[model samples]
Target: MSKGPVLLTGSAGFIGFHTARRLLARGETVIGVDNLNSYYDPALKQARLERLQAEPGYIHHTLDLADRPGMTAVFAGHAPRRIVHLGAQAGVRYSLEHPESYVDSNVVGFLTVLEGARAVQAEHLVFASTSSAFGANGALPFSVRQGVAHPMTVYAATKIANEAMAHSYSHLFGFPSTGLRFFTVYGPWGRPDMALFKFTRAILEGRPIDVYGHGEMERDFTYVDDIVDGVIAALDRPAAADPDWDAAMPDPSTSGVAPWRILNLGAGRREQLMRYIAVLEEALGMKAELNLMPVQDGDVARTEADVTETRAALGYAPSTSIEVGVKRFVDWYRDFYGV
Candidate 1:
């Protein structure tokens, strides 16, 4: 009995490309979708797609998630049993400039996915969330149980809305859905917008790098492979209505009546920004000229993940240290760019 193909959005994006590749390796038919917009460089997205195109089990569509009719057609045509909705206009700082893009892709695009999931009665729906949803909370190692009522940025607000929307769909349609709050995902074939890639490129080019929060910030910095492990595990185990869920003191991580839950997918260890830079410097063997700056709008000083629920539920453990991870990224960057 072959379950239908997995419909994966953002297939050309960094994490999506990795997830799609792993799925293909495990013999899963992956139906990939991505607009390949110029948010960063479309060439990078195209490069990723070229690799996936070589895999026999991979199918791709160049469509935006917000395109409701196109997405509906895909669901009807493919009949996907499971969906990994990873497409969104991603960027904390960019949200400050173009909030509409976040609303269109994250809000409107999410609605189309929920509709498609309902139409197919998807066995499981796993979507990407962000740790930035923990905005305005100075708590260490953020837990899924913490209330996400104060999202400081439009991007975070849109992801938080996706959780609520999925929960309602799960309750009304009797399908299972899981949301994963990823913390600072980075690795080979990484996005240029991320701190890791930017720092590496600047250091290699002998350019000064901007150190936000005056180099005092910290991040959980989960590697791409670890995140993919958590995603596949969560996808395999669908959410269920919590039997012991109490409405009096509702658990933010699970639902009382709905088969819906959220979990943190992170390394569960906080590393200082300076240490991460140092690791990158060691990898490139070049020191970065630092321009210390105040934290930008919609930026949190520090972010840590409490992945206890993730580990207990999915047996998830993130093993990559900054040293190994930075080295891998630098090696890939050099090879890819001929630097």
Candidate 2:
């Protein structure tokens, strides 16, 4: 009568770490895997790993996803019943500077994770994708049902590729897979490279923070807790083939024949960049010195998530308001860094 252990990749990362923490707290076993590479700072990653290690139900596996032999061995050894693939070369701007990193981790590494699912016969495989996949769309709220083809950056392109790869795996191998197109996920123990963290850090230290798009950008800033809830819900119920799916007029969100689906996990409403900064300022009690600049390379002007399908399928509704979310995150930052 054992509820199967969930295999969580990128367990050292921000979102992955949060997901693992929540699962462990719920008395669920998580087989956490990560190479612990120096993407931002290995110290931060190591700290995350330490937190997971302290949890009773968490087991650690230090291995790169692209190391097929090592990854395969871990999967075969654990025989994980469920797979949550969150590891990838993140950061849209970073992708331009280091295209190879994106290829190695996002593309090659993703394929290895899929192979592990295939080998272990995981019941449900959920992978993390980005809202950036809807690049150059200029749509109000990015929808899962819409076709995403024009990705501006390599990172987005890779995610789009992942969706295609997962579909093939679902169709040919009969694996039930789900891809979460995450919006701007921010919270405590978050990525140092992310905007919220960067802005808070700079503002606290009295340094000028770069405000991209001349402070004209907006984002559907989904809290980490909300994103984690969506992830677990998606796993609890495996995606099924859309019974009414029409092959002639294919629905891009769900598969016609394969048990595959894509969901937008975000705070349905979008917020302006200035508004987010104001929230952070209030939480920190410090004003930021803005270094207004034109849109940086590989950066988007805005991002809005359409969570209608996600809400319908998994009863997903993100509850954390910006005020509460920002306050909590800043509180954690104060404690984390003793600020």
Candidate 3:
């Protein structure tokens, strides 16, 4: 069966770029959209867009999710079959500084996307959530079934709102929706604010790298390619209302009233912060000057995702080791920055 054109928001962002590229490679048409905001380096975002612009099956739109008229126009014009809504105000710490951006982008903007998806009757609307949504839970491995009412950061709070908003839209509009809670995703063309990117840059520049949580934190850092694969899989397979989903004993991950589901996309392996830095050092052949610090407010000590349901649903298996992934990221950094 021919997969119709995909309307992919955040096509200039890391995972979005990779997903669009993969879809294009598979001969699927993609209508890419991004506001090109200066959340990070806009130049980096532009460079990612440049790559996608080169592809034949791609059409680019410079627009924001909060711009209802703009977003609605795109949907009206393209009428995409599937929508991958990855655009949002990302960054946990930054949310501490600017909380309104999260509200505008993640909350209001997500509502706009949901409305558009409903209007167009999209086959599936797959959107990005975060592992940080597992805030204040003392659990070792976070699962979708766990209650995520206690969000540590405004960014996570916004994502939780997104999940609820999507569910409501699914129930009312009958469009399938899936929310992916991504772990620490890192790889080539990654976000500059992320730990791996910042660490790599500071180490290469002979500067001190901030080791939060006093080097005791751990993350289930999934590779970008693995995440992109899971996202595409979820997009292809629309969510279905679970027959076993009882209202008396509701599953947080599945829906009884609507075709809405949540899944964790992680490598299923937690690596320590110190060990991750070591792998980066090995890749760059340079040891970092670490400035150990207390765990920031809104920071979790550890995060590990239970991907059993993800594996069963999508046949997801993350194949990249930290060593290999870090090496690949370093290679890309050096080549891109001319270092």
Candidate 4:
């Protein structure tokens, strides 16, 4: 028998848009969902949706994940057995300004998703987490094995809640779930709120760009294509209870009681913020008027992900360099915006 359609939330966002395209290319039926909120430019989201609409095996619904009845009806109607729950109000700084938004979308919306998965007894569910969950940790490379008890922002906190909620459902419902903690993902069709897009736009417009942490920050900066690869790989391989999981020495990445796990999806290399800006300048052939300042509230100075488990489990290999990724983004931005 054929597989049911993959219920993919946030299908209009950056990572979601890319993941949808990849899935469609592989001849998989995709049920795309997105609220297309005005958190950022809705035009970008619409533009992405237009592209997906042109492809075969793609179905889209304009709905919010927090709508419990709406999501339940979708599950009952389509009965998707594999779900990629990527929809969430994403942004650390925005979460500070609108903490309630995070609770509604990331927390409440996630509950609806969990309920839907339980209703369908989903074979596997993969959801997006973030590296910011490691806030206040001074570790060089963030690992899923490490304890993430110090999330500095409401956004990260909600993601941690999602992980816990997914684990409980997996344990209770006898389904599998996986959470991917994505590092600073970038590339073409990226969010305007992200550093890369903001810097690129400002440089082209001859506007000053904020240099947080006095340009001393670092980021793993995984490309969007690499992120899609990791997401699909994790989606294909359902999680299973780790036999070696001991109560006395529990591994945070896996659970003995549930078929649930978390993995870090990143490039496994740290690039300084200054170096990143310099690359942007080179790509756009324009120097940015830097407005140096201290790190903003709910901001971390650096982030790197240890992808050892991701590699061993999924054969994940991130081959994009900062230089190449930035160049690709610049090319796409210019073509898309006619800049």
lDDT of 1 by residue, 227-262 (tens): 999999999999999999999999999999999999
Segments of candidate 2 deviating more than 4 angstroms? none
**Overall lDDT per candidate, in order of appearance:** 0.94, 0.91, 0.94, 0.95
Provide TM-scores for the models: 0.99, 0.98, 0.99, 0.99
Pairs clashing within candidate 4: none
Find the 10 residues in a row with the least total lDDT in model 3: 1-10
Instruction: Give the better candidate number (2 or 4) by lDDT.
Output: 4
Which stretch of 10 consecutive residues in model 2 shows the poorest summed lDDT? Answer: 1-10
Cα miss at 200, model 3 (Å)?
0.9
Clash pairs (backbone) in predicted model 1: none
lDDT of 2 by residue, 145-206 (tens): 77888899999999999999999998888879999999999999999999989998999999
Decoy 1 TM-score against native: 0.99
Distance from true location, Cα of 48 in model 4, Å:
0.3
Clashing pairs in 2: none
For 1-339, candidate 4 gives per-residue lDDT tens digits of 238899999999999999999999999999999999999999999999999999989999999999999999899999999999899999989987799999999999999999999999899999999999888988888989999899999999999999999999999998999999999999999999999999999989989999999999999999999999999999999999999999899999999999999999999999999999999999998899999999999999999999999999899999999999999999999999999
